[model samples]
Target: MPALRALAAAVFLAHPAWADTATETAERAAADLREAIATLDQAEGARNRIAALTQTIRAYELGLTALREGLRSSAIREDEIRASFEAQRDTIGQLLAAMAAMEAAPGPLVLLHPDGPEAAARTGMILTSVQPALEAEAAKLRADLQEIARMRALQVSAHSALQEGLSAAQAARTALSQAVQDRTDLPQRFLEDPEELQALVANAETLEGFARGVARLQSDIGPPMEDFASAEGTLPLPVVGTLLRRAGEADAAGIVRPGMLIATRPAALVTTPWPATIRYRGPLLDYGNVMIVEPAAGYLLVLAGLATVYGETGDVLDAGAPVGLMGGDETALAQGAGAERPETLYIELRRDAEPIDPAPWFEQTREE
Candidate 1:
């Protein structure tokens, strides 16, 4: 009877260790997934801002350019040019001022008119004065209004884009949170099922699947669900940099393990776009800059540790457009190790969020 009791005790005691490890692993993976989603969200927000600003600037530039060209053919050349050109130029300055105001405003409100009613009223009066046959100032004002409308449309689209990204990010956060909870509950839930506990841990395929999903989520969105295999885009880096750590490796700061490591010239850039939707941009993290491209369902393009992030989210890009610049700072590059210089951008490819050697994918893409 004592021997039988001892055997039972040994079995029960060893069970908790395996459960703990599984829980820890799941929690770590969930956290990494959540962080990646959050980074994407940030990049999208930045892209929206850039788009709004760019659209506004372009509107102002076009209007001014037209007004200047019109002045060249004026019947009352000097007088009309002074009165009309100067006022329109002032309007251009005002528009820029409006941009600054929009920047300072909250959310996408930057797309709205920067000047309050007073500025609009003043501009209206100026337009009235400049509406002579000598210049088509009224037409120009109308064109400016239309330009603002186009910009506002873009901002509206961007707001929707934000909603989608936030949803995905929230999904990732929830998955991680649930995973942590699962870990915490495992001991009690499977207290009597030693076999079950062993089975779950041994299923490395489950872990691999989760990793693969992460990789897929990180891939770029092109033409609405372009499979990793069908999409013909590159890694978005213009310069060749040293490869850093592999996917699922611990980061130097030890904050959390990275999905992948990329080395680049201290300040090089890598760029990509928001996957599937034209409303958000890519470059979601700060551990340098990064871009994820989805060429097919099972593969992802990753470029990390960039110096600068260029290009707006939602903007369609060519296959090899420069997404961001790589870093060249010696102090920044020292984050890794000796003999193996850290001044290179790391490149990686993963299938369904799990890291796979990118070499084959690169070869395949190059051959095509």
Candidate 2:
């Protein structure tokens, strides 16, 4: 199957399960991970190795994310089933005790009631009427037990696949970084003047000022990306993550910023949302490993909090090309340690000196 289709299917694998859905979900996740691993291995020979590796990483992420959610949901179901069993413990005990009584009675006397023949007949009638319901409950018990076992097996199997996928993704990232560096064929629109950029960064007081300064430094000989302005509200998010905060949304400290924040897994791939020229890429002020690119004459996109950056000043990047990877240990997400290794990417869109809400530009950013 195609990469995006695989990811879409994998992401939904963890949706609410019934009798056999959870097991099938785990099965699909495992298969998807294997496919992603295969893709990683084949990426080296692909013409566009960077794009291949990026897709591979995303495949692993979506599968693992779905698998994790499925695991959590399965656990809840297991707990509920156990609780249900526990809550009926007294009833179960009574049933067992009744069975023991029947077993202890002599075979010939089993159907006999000490009271009389009429009472014995009524007793037999009651037993006959209740047998089907009892059998049904017994069958349900068997099914629940089997489901619990299957879920446990699913978890056990997912762990090794998770670890393997994580390791492969890490290696892919390392290779991708090298590939981006080794690449020499990308077109350059203009080279940034180091001194001019340094002066701007040094004098800039806020993000808006820095973005404006970068825009002023851009002197691309080529025309801006055609129809870039018309591409509004159609661009996908540069990375896969949950929207942590919208543009101008306040943080925990009640501080509002122009950029939006996204919560991603460790070492998540960050790509260019559109074809753009790298205006500047490096640590500036407090933003760590920032990459500012101009997708149009007056529009600049700022991505910060990346662990490693790719491309150099003036190199033109195709839309969806890998720009960098989010910071954090890649294995941490699979180990259920994401809370301890939370990685967030800050994205800001600037039109000239004014900051604009990125949600209106990227459709995924508006997802609640």
Candidate 3:
């Protein structure tokens, strides 16, 4: 019996109630997911809607991934664990029922009476045999309780994430409607025929072809251009962020793209640093979403990796006008150790279709 008691004590000490660390991590992730959803809900305007929806989707994906990993690490095969718990509970119930029936009769002390000596010995032997089994059951019950607590915590985390995801999806649908309306209400500037523009857009084989087509149309309209050269070293960055990659730096693919990458907060506003005419706005090659603005007659400023864009082609924007927003996905940052990679925006300046270094244009203070 002493040995049995020691074994039970060992089991109890070895498996303390499943630690709350995993659940706490999941809860933290869920809280972030909720905050992201709220941000999406507050976003107004078509451009904001695009940014919000993009961020909301990314948040959902990341939150789901975290919850899955938490569950996998903390509770392997939850279904099997639950089944074992149920079996243990049933056994405990049966044991309790038997003990209760025995209690209704004379107590164990009653067996000490003169006529009950033989019966007392028999009962003693029976109890001795049952002692080890009872102790084992007690140990298993403790394990079951711990497991159930962890499972319950995981369930709550999952439920919260699912609710947040649903809300984000609904908000995205409404935002999409408003975005379409906003696009329709934008004033047209270029006198080019819509059919011709559409055909040109369709026929363009690559981003360069599309840019060339738009340049041709802009040349015909002859929109007023801003003196971008004069603003060099004085212009603010299009978005408030930390510079992560400089122009001429090789990326993970070992390709040196003539552009600078800036890491910004999720759904951060992207603005034009100088007066410009929107020349092109849409997806371009590997750059998820892009906007090409002509700050000068021959110079085009390309902003890429945006989740949402505000201005349409031919629309003239003053210096500091909002153009688009950075995306919210952080998977790029997750690849590096201890890297604070946030949403990134790629900026490129071009002179007659030739890419040029854009670092010289922005203030050094802003870069720092």
Candidate 4:
């Protein structure tokens, strides 16, 4: 039983878990890229086309990122295995050479040697004791060889995945560029002076004040030409992430707010999930950077906590057009310090100044 346990331990130690992890990561990245391509192929209209293309680009980028990470991980594992094998190289070589010498001298000859009966008997007993240990060492060597082979294979697979990811990303980018050029009918509900909007956002004391100030600016652009009420339960999220907070949830200060928070990767691209005109894009209150997009008649979409703002106040953005990016990296200033925190975006949907739950507007399956 102890011998069996030792063998099992040797096998376990020979095979590192990083190889499996890298393979799984590669598989997942491939799956994501495939899904992205499928989404783009299925898009029908300009709005859907832009959205799908944007999503495909994002997916390709993410897939490439994951593949590169997997490649790095695989390389590290490979180096570790090589180092371990090199450390044992001399021992394994000596064991093999000793085994070869033993094979050249038969057991019967060693036992019947002319040295003496006592010496031959002692030699036979020593061989008997060392044989099992030698066999165990050989078994461990075989295991190590197998593990090295597996690591090499994993490295090859990682390299292949990286190449595939790069190719797919390049193709996706090309398609995205073409799609952007083909798009023409993006709706624009309101237009505001960038300078005035920036000043208003900078001067606003609270979110409510910011919202009101935006409402005053939008009063001149006339009502939305389209209705967003019919699009309930179907709108895709602006970013790919996990929902952290729901509407009316209490914050650390115990104050309930009417918005949802999404936790996403650092510097994740933010997009308009629907056709909207940019109303405000700047700092407001405690929110780092905010973008107010009006997507429909009498409705405002407030997306805050961004590290960087992209479009100006008057720019009309179609669904999935780039708006800004989430904060967390060095390029985008982190809002909170001391410890690393996951990038989070606060989103709210408002009808004329009143905050409403945006949960019902988006697909339930996507919220997670």
Each model's lDDT: 0.39, 0.76, 0.65, 0.67
Ranking of candidates on TM-score, top first:
2, 4, 3, 1
Candidate 4 per-residue lDDT, tens place, 1-368, comes to 23433443454455444435544565565566556545545443445665665666577546544654555565565577678768756655666776677779865688685889998887777666666766766675675566557556755654554455445544544555566556556544444465667777558788877886777664444565556888888988887676888998898989888889987766666888888878878777789998998887578999999987765566677677877767765222121122445689889999877888988888852345
Q: Using lDDT as the measure, what is the rank order of every candidate, best first? A: 2, 4, 3, 1
- Candidate no. 2 TM-score: 0.84
TM-score of structure candidate 4: 0.55
Q: Candidate 1 or 4, higher lDDT? A: 4
Which clashing pairs does model 3 show? none
**Which 10 residues in a row give candidate 4 its minimum summed lDDT?**
330-339
Cα lDDT of model 3 overall? Answer: 0.65
lDDT of 3 at 75: 56
The regions of model 3 sitting more than 4 angstroms off are: 1-187, 191-209, 220-226, 329-341, 365-368
lDDT of 1 at 198: 32
Instruction: Please say which candidate is ahead in lDDT: 2 or 3.
Output: 2
lDDT of 1 by residue, 273-355 (tens): 32321121233334345444454445555655555554333334434334555545433222212233445655655655556
Q: How many backbone clashes does candidate 4 have?
A: 0
Tens-digit per-residue lDDT, 1-368, candidate 2 = 13323332332232223655555666776777778877888886788888888888777777777777677777788897788668766665554555456457675574567988887777766655554444445456667788889888877887777777777887888888888989988988655546888888778676667887787774563786567898888898888888888887789999899899988877888999899888888777676788998888888899998888988888888888888888877666666553545689999998865788888788876544
The list of candidate 4 runs beyond 4 A from truth reads 1-56, 61-199, 220-225, 330-340, 364-368
Instruction: Please give the distance, in angstroms, between residue 185's alpha carbon in candidate 2 and its true position after superposition.
Output: 1.4
Which candidate do you rate higher for lDDT, 3 or 4? 4
lDDT of 2: 0.76
